[model samples]
Target: MRKWGPLVAVCLGTFMLLLDVTIVIVALPDIAGELGASLTGLQWVIDVYALVLAALLLGAGAAADVLGRRRVYAAGTALFTLASVGCGLAPGTGALVAMRGVQGLGAAAMFATTLSLLGAAYRGRDRSFALGMWGAVSGAAAALGPVLGGVLTQGLGWEWIFFMNVPVGAVAIWLTLNAVAPDGARGTRRLDLAGAAAFALFAGATTYAAVRAGEEGWTSGRTLAVFGVAAVALVLFGRAERRAVDPLLDLSLLRRGAFVTVLVAGLAYNAAAFGVMPYVSVWLQTVLGLSPVRAGLALLPLAAVSFVVAAAGGRLLHGAQARFVLGGGLLLIGGGTLGQAVLDADSGWASLSAGLAVSGVGVGLVSPALGGAALASVPARHSGMAGGAVNTFRQLGFALGIAVFGTVATSRMTDVLHDGGAARELAGGGAAALRGTVPDEVLRTAFASGLDGALTAAGVLGLVGGLAALAWVRSPGPEAETEAKAESERDRGDGVPAVGAGAPASPGGA
Candidate 1:
């Protein structure tokens, strides 16, 4: 009970953080209507959260080690709670976007410390089980986000979606304060400010360029300048990391084949699954004419199946080779996404449900396995950094996926409607413009065509991820497993119970 209490505290925060990702997706249409935001504005609302989180995660992890994991986690929880309040009370789109960025900063702190806290609390087989449980929570939270958001948006209001985080975050803070142990002392390692700055600049610049290209032309001067800035920042980041005594990100992790494979797999899963979810939600509402509640219910199959699959996948990671599981998962995702590409303006909910279920299963299989593989590939001491790295890649993939898919869909729709006056109105007025100006038949068909194109691209990316896993991911050797078990036995022999047994009580003894 004592050992598991901290896990619960961290998981609660994780669930809220991830839930915010998909929750806002279903609410975007409502937000756009109320705020009079353009399509580019919607993209920023989504992109900035991921962009900031991805940027700061590396630094957060390093800071946790140097300062204290519990301290960082507590501070993050407070910030997230306050920021959620700001989001709910935001006066306009700009205010909401800024608050979301603040929420991302808070989320980065909690996320980077989560796995490290678990590692500190548990060991050996118990650690594996804890991680699997963590994975399940992640999938379930994401799965529930849309439905919950939809229900809130339709029944209460869109603001309730952010408002709901307050109580949950409050509870999480209490649990964290009571359940987690305090750090023994601060480490002497210097914070890698240079590496952190360079990486953040590179990531933020690239994402900004992608979002700008989606609105302005790809070749626009502003976009080109941002791209150039991104390129130079990335080069500088690499140099800074190489020279740093304590790099924010250990570039050497890329040299390990397993780590690289896991990273790619993580990116692919997020790109195909989390990245495309918002657009799908929009399509359901605008093209299919489903209300927010109905649209959320429609996505239930994907979330439910993913939730179950992630739990099973985590347990499977104990005995099975991650390569097979990850490859198989990616294949499922590709097939599922490809199925969605077949959707047409006249298609019913049955087709969408089937495709979503398949993809959810794939996501389930990938989530836990990818996390486990990334942690296992790195040295034990580097687990916090490894966790941050994996999440950074996943979030970056999410940002890129949203930018690319949104651009494709919007551009294709514009091209189809180019001759119509409504096209110009859409460019300026956003989705609200289509409500009365464009004919229903024309709007549906054009948007459907754009959706198909986007799905096709996402499907191809999923296939590539699967193939990469198959080619590169491998099982740890039997000797390594034996040594790990022996280490566990030695710990037990030294009067330490396995985690979840009679392990040491947390500091405050919650």
Candidate 2:
């Protein structure tokens, strides 16, 4: 029990935080219906958690290093539990979105610490075994989220999805306090509070602009104003990074072509892959009349194939170059997303299976390789930054993708329907609610058209990512590689964390 206790505790927090990413998908209709949420509100509910999680991860990771990993992990679990209860009891769309953002804050803290906690707890073979187990558990989140959410929503109501966490979090908190080791010594790195704040402001502003653009025209005064804020925040973030003693993002890493390519790949891989699933969940329930369980099951092909392909890739392609693997995977993701763009009014849910499976291959191929690829591209001293940057971009990709795709979908639906006002309602899983007033056939056509647009947008992003990767990314020369390994060992001896000094999360997703 002593030996395995830390692994179990860390996994509990990891699974809950990641599961909430997609678990909210299957319950969107219920949430929209019960809360009377607008399309924008619905988008906020989904995107805010991801946005905050991405923004805070780097900052939170540094905090864990300073304040102690177990200490931060325990506080995060407690906060997440309380916030989950808040979400379950939220009285309206606004309250729910606010609580979900709090959930993200808690999630970021927990995520930032989990792997580091493992690194501190285990050694040698046990470290390898523990990390492998942790990765396996993390992979299960993307596969099981929708299915578990479905069972909870249909059988127990949507609230149980959040409510279910209370017991698990309580147990995790207990274990973290009792079983995990104390910090050995505090590090010298000071918190880059300026960098963290500026980055958060930038991310939040940009996402708000994307969401608002879907409502007010892109050229509208309100939309343009928010965009102006985003631009300013981005500039501030850059300045802060430049001035920091220990920056959240190291600017020097951006000079390397391989490192830059990996960052782009992280953004494209997540945005193109999992960003469109929430809308699919909507169409399944509101348009197709499938039960939540059935809707979740329909999405299972992608997750299942991803799991199998990832396991196979790890074994068979262990020695393969990351460029070919990641590039090829992204190409497959593009192909799969484009294939699904064929959906029409007459198409059924089964039309998504082949495309989902293809994208799954891409997801599996790219996910496990991300950290290794990032680590190899930069100097050993920058490895921790690379790891955290990969996750930041990946989550940022999801948030931005959701915002952009939602806009594309609503715009396309408005085009098809020729009624701008109805587009928002229809996009927010309101088809069943609007049925008697609007013709069912029209609703179906508009929804299909909107989905086609969103999928096409995601597909194009994927293709660009693939081609960029193929053209530019390269493995280091033998000399550089050897030097990096030596430096990495020295860093270890000096008690520096190899990856995620700020953070690296499990990369698997919807």
lDDT of 1 at 235: 95
Model 1 alpha-carbon drift over 4 Å, by segment: 1-3, 123-126, 379-381, 419-432, 478-510
Clashes of each: 0, 0
Name the candidate that leads on TM-score: 2
lDDT of 2 at 66: 81
- Give residue 231's lDDT in candidate 1 (0 to 100): 96
Candidate topping lDDT: 2
Model 2: residues with Cα > 4 Å off, grouped in runs: 491-510
lDDT of each: 0.76, 0.83
